[model samples]
Target chain A: MKRVTLFVGHYGSGKSNLAVNYALMLRSCGKPAALADMDIVNPYFRSADSARELEDAGVRVIALPFANTNVDLPALPSAIYGLVESRSEYAVLDVGGDDRGALALGRFVPYILEENDYEVLYVVNFYRPLTGNANDALEVMREIETAAGIRCTGIVNDSNLGGETAPSDIEATVPLARELAALSGLPLVFTAYDARLPRPDVPGPFPLTLQRRPV
Target chain B: MGNKVLMKGNEAIAEAAIRSGCRHYLGYPITPQTELAAYMAKRMPKIGGVFLQAESEIAAINMVYGVAATGRRVMTSSSSPGISLKQEGISYIAGSDLPCLIVNVQRGGPGLGGIQPSQSDYFQATKGGGHGDYHLIVVAPSSVQEMAQLTGLAFDLAEKYRMPAMLLADGTVGQMMEPVELPDEKDVEFTEKDWAVTGTKMQRPHHIVNSLYLVPDELERKNFERFERYRRIQETEARYESFLMDDAEICVVAFGIAARVSKNAVLAARAEGLKVGMIRPITLWPFPSQALKEAADRVKGFVSVELSMGQMIEDIKLAISCRKPVELVNRAGGMIMSPDEVLAGIRKMNGGDNQ
Candidate 1:
């Protein structure tokens, strides 16, 4: 596993949910994990919404004050710097949605790039209307990469139709994900799906607990 | 071909509005409806549609009036306080007998309130937000898919009736994600606009579009004519979903995000051996009152589940004509009622232990 894992993608591409599950997965595997919510654009459902869950599992959570609030306080705390600098901790940064959101990750690029131990995972959803196809997904990915000032090392297919998601839905996105991987010249890392359901019949599937705040 | 894609509720509404041939989108940004405007800002320019970020909500609604006068599909969206800013323009649109769509993804408010979800704008939508002797066709959607579907429906109804239509939603439905199949552009059929102010080329009489009638008699005639159309709508357009209501003893009335929560609550209450069911109103203006009136005959009582402080409760009571007792289950100022809370309301209405 890479020392630093950053998830970046189009909005509603399931980045935050996967990021929360990833941190929990890392901690369960007896690894020191930390998650930093960099989503300043979205008003709700950031990785920080699952802060209490991550903390309960012995994973460190870093987010701006009023992270889950309706207030659009786009301030990032200095605690996020500690996440990247710590050599012993496995850092997972949930970069906000789309190019607009990726702009927030700009200032941290130099530190992340120079370390040479980071893997920026460009999360793509084939079921999202705007970035549904491979070409559109690549264009969004390029824009996000430009805005964040970093290159994506791998592609994570995190496609699903929200609550109505079926295993077939995840399977149907395989070709699109592969095409995205081919066009972007990045390796297809994993396909994410709800872990509570039966495992999807796909290779390198990453099952997630589907992180959401208890309503 | 149906392509069901995952979409946030706000984005779904925007996409469906475009698919419904809405060519002009003018709006000022306000959460949690900001994504709807942002989606239009990105997609409209690419599709040969106009997406203008007006100076303010007032400016946006006036721009909507401009496009609407030209007999083209136009819309503007905002949250609660922002909607309040557009009321003057909305009243003007209604007074002029123009067709357009106004979307309110409601947030809690008497004022700025908060950005979180609230259905406090129910009275503002159905009763009197725009000060006038008129009604704007109001529809509320429970799911993300419904958000898209109802956007198309609202535009069609607005044009058909030559009136303004409001898609009254809340932050929960507007910001949440779900699998949705957006309406196809080819499938949307807009009504002809013979009353529009299109250029006559001096060969025919020019069409004049104005809301002003200095003569009281003329204004009163317009008001009477508009109410006649509203009567037809109230008779024919009231839409609602009856969930497990056939054998229900307790009918729960709700809409938008509240209906979704109430659905789960009704299901849970049923599982607990309570004869509770749900009536989710889709059209808030021509509210499914007659259906509730009919339900009142069979059901012993009614429960109104809402995110507001009992705004819709009054509507339910009036609908059933006080035929049966009606109780309220609500939370205000960005708070939402849980399925458990709604189930408790159902049980309490049932007099506990499955009365």
Candidate 2:
């Protein structure tokens, strides 16, 4: 697993949900995991909104001061810097959705780039209108990378229909995920699924406990 | 024209705007409606159109005003709070009688409420949101296909009436995916505006697009003329859909996402030998009062199902004129009213002897 995993995707693509689940997944494997909630664009369904659950699971959570508040300011808490610099086994950055949201990630590009051990995972949900197809997903990936000043190292197929997700839904997106992987020249690292659902045949299928609902 | 593509409601609205000859889109990023702006940003440049991300919602609506004054089919979209910020500009557009499209993918709010889908903005959208004696031609779409179709209709109505039109959608419709048969790109001919601010190259008098009138009488005349246009709109442009109302004893009135839920509940109630039906108001500003008044004579009672705490109920009562009792089935603050909850409400109304 990459030490520093940055999860980026469009809104309602389940990035924050997966980020929170991934943090707990890492800790369950005995790896010290810390999560940085860099999503200042969306006020709901963010990793910061699930900070209590994540912290209860023994995972460190870093969130903005005004997170989950009605104050829609884009002020990132300074604690994010300290969280990133600490000697944790794994650090997950739950980025905001889309290019405009990814602008917040630009400030940490220098530190992230200097580390040289970070991986940006572009979470793709075939259900989302903007990233529904391979071409659209690729376009969104390019836009996010351009805005964040970083290259996406892999794709995480997080295709879902919120709580209505079925196994067919997971199976249906495998081909699009593969096409997106080929078009973007990035690896399909994993397919995010509910842990309670029957896993598909795809390799590296990451089962996640559904923590957050779609915003 | 037969191609069906799965699409989100927000993206469908954007594509429909493009196909309807909208060349200018200015908006700020807000959840539940951001996909519309993002879709426009990607496709507008390819089509040689302008998609500008403004500094704020206030700026975006003002930009719409500028683009509308140029006689171009332009649009701006935002969620509830952002739409609140654009009220001043919306009023200005209304006063100037400029045609434009504004989409509100509504979230919960009295303040910066939760980002979940809600019908709390019905009063704001149907009633004048901005401070003025004005009315936005409000179209409420119930599905993804309607999201696209009503967008085309919104532009057509806006241009036809020489007034602003609003596509009032909730977060559920904005985010949900459904197969939609998109409209073909047509060569839409906009109504030639003799009052547009196109530069006068010595062919005619200079056209000025301003809302200000220092004289009280002139301002009153403008208001009267605008109200006259609104009267025409109310006369001819009211739109609504009736489902299973012929033999329905209990009629549920709703619009947008709430109507979608009400349809399911109505069907489920009918399955158990209860007579339930739905009246979906497609045009909220015109209110569909005539249809409701006609339905009130036939149906036993009315039940209003909405995502807000009874905002549309007052209009329902006013439309029916207290001839029938109107019950409310709603969940406020971003909580969706489930079909089961609506079904229970239907049963409660069905068991009552008040009707």
Q: TM-score of each candidate?
A: 0.96, 0.79
Per-model chain B TM-scores are: 0.97, 0.97
lDDT string for model 1 (A1-215, tens) is 99899999999898999899889989999999999999888876788888898999999989878765665579988988777776679999999998999999988878887788999999988888889799999999999999999999999998888778889888888988999989999999999989876888875999988776534
Candidate 2 steric clashes: 0
Report i-RMS for every model: 2.3, 6.4
lDDT of 2 at A58: 90
DockQ by candidate, in order: 0.66, 0.14
Model 1, which residues run further than 4 Å from truth? A69-72, A213-215, B187-192, B353-355
Against the reference, the lDDT scores of all candidates come to 0.89, 0.87
lDDT of 2 by residue, A18-106 (tens): 89988998988999989988877665456877878888989988888876566667799887776556545589999998887888988
Distance (Å) between predicted and true CA of B308, model 2?
4.2
Worst 10 residues of 2 chain A by lDDT: A80-89
lDDT by residue for model 1 (B169-274), tens: 9999988888887777844354546888878988778889998899999989989999999999999999999999999999999999888888999999889888
Candidate 2 lDDT over B43-139, as tens digits, reads 8999889999999999999999999998999999999999999999999999999999999999998898888898899888988999979999999
Q: TM-score, B chain, candidate 1?
A: 0.97
lDDT of 2: 0.87
